[model samples]
Target: MPRRASGPRLYLDKKRRQWAIRDGANFIRTGCPEAKLEWAEKLLAKYIAAKYSPPKSASPPIADILLFYLKDRVPMMKSRSAKYNVANLEKFWGDKLLSDVTPANCRAYARTRSQSAARADLEKLQSAINHWHSERATLPAIPKVWKPPRNEPRDRWLTVSEAARLVKASKRAEHLKRFVLLGLYTGSRAGVLRTLEWSWIDLEAGTMRRRAPGASEVANKRTPPIRLPRKLKHFLRRWKVADGGQCKYVVHYNGQPILRDPWRSWKEACKAAGLVGVHPHVLRHTRATWMVQRGVPPWQAAGYLGMTVRVLEATYGHHSPDWQAEAADI
Candidate 1:
């Protein structure tokens, strides 16, 4: 008996413990039984057809490409901020083809939305298109998207006295005091804190495990635990003792977790503290600013705040007392 020549080679992959089909340089692994040569051939045919198939058009629908990109990229996104980008981009340009997305189209989108929103959407689109092109080795000429001027990072920060005032004022609102304190001390986002469970916190160890809800701890690279400040730890101790230490969440109202927006209570606390335009996120800014002002290293501050060193430098570098101080000596 002689071996028959086939379109592509087929063999058993010992490492994968599966039958594999080789299409030129590409290998497709399948769980088909080794004796099932007919199934392997069918799979190889499908794989080769899909792999070598020409694009339906020179430029497919932008929406189609965007969908593909989102399918691949969304899972890797560790923050909820990407949702805004996805929504905005799809809303404006989902129907258009890649070739039809012109500078004017981008400008029109920008005009309809704010420049910041346009910038975010276009940047996401650009990234998606770039990835698609890289995968297919087809680089189509694309219009340049205009980006809005980057605004100066907000410098609003609360002094220790101001923070104390806000925390004290928030005591009137159930759970707001602890929320404010945790925000100011940990620099964790409101969403993270709101869905936080008792299991993640370690009072004796003086640490709290932090990660975006529904995100995989092992898969997500961005969200990580933040150390509890001594003040926050002490506050938590007292809070736990008072609450009988049985509640599932750290911030609760009348034995229930505070899951929804706490805007009313936040506003009241801000007003009482005489702070203007302050929000939950400002507590994060305040914490980062305070850390930099107190001479904490940029890397350490970034780690504590669950951001990168580049972001730390770009946003809060100016607040660091040591930053650019040597220029005066020169």
Candidate 2:
């Protein structure tokens, strides 16, 4: 006696002039005509075989896992920083298998990149691998990666006189003065300020928003409204009225967006100002330090500066007037 077919039943749809496989109530169209019933039958057989095949026991390669994470997880993230880290990770370990990312491999990567960068890459990789393992249950044990010691936060701050000199020297770079002033007063990151637009500024409310409308709120990176200082508000009011109110970006050079790094201009201004090793980020450090020294509560300052109170205290606490007060009391 002939054995019955175990796969889906194959039939031709007269109306559509196509062959289809019927599995229970579902009919999957094969797009083949009735003349190709043999082809449709073979395709159906393969599909049945695949559906019944046992699950693979081996863990996916690191490259495959990273691809999955980027496709499925990265899109859901509100923070662009994760995407940036993933890009760097892909560049470093695009071809490596998950099992190959041992501690030695991590150390090798650290040799090529900075300690902090290497740590971030490894953490991302670990998270991706763990996620894959959770879904597939293939890996017996996740690979261990070495972590570098955290570096102390930078302690560079600018004095009021130095800041004034820098601004005075930035006279040649049309927007550099305003940019410096904003950084000094607001304590916002250079990237955030560089991308800031006039639309996010509410002069009437005496505040400036870091992000634009409809932009994703970056994780742990709040775009809190920065209350304008009296000096900054006065400068911005005059600057806005002077331009005939027609520019889009808050920081522009000759009406063009200062999209690229203004390193050369900044260096020249620093030289003229007699300031050494001054960078745009140092302005953020300076502002935070000044806030602490001037007795601004850590919580209030952190909110205004778009950082956590822990980070504020960790980095700028030494500048706080209350720093080490308990120790002195003892």
For all candidates, what are the clash counts?
0, 1
Candidate 2 collision pairs = 62-98
Best by lDDT: 2
Error of 1 at 293 (Å): 1.5
Q: What lDDT would each prediction earn against the true structure? A: 0.77, 0.80
Model 1 agreement with the true structure over 1-330: per-residue lDDT tens digits:
966545566778876656898755677787787778789878877776445433534477777667666666666875666667877788878778777677778778878877666777778888877766766446657555566665566778889999889988998985898888888988877877787777788888887888534657533345688778887888888888888867888888888988675898899888998888986888888989999999998889888888889888988898888888899779
* Model 1 regions lying over 4 Å from their true place: 1-57, 69-84, 131-144, 212-221
TM for every model, in the order presented, reads 0.71, 0.75
lDDT of 2 by residue, 54-96 (tens): 2434556666677667766778886566777777878778887
Q: Please list the Cα RMSD from the true structure of every candidate, rounded to 1 decimal place.
A: 11.4, 9.4
Q: How high is the lDDT of residue 191 in model 2?
A: 78
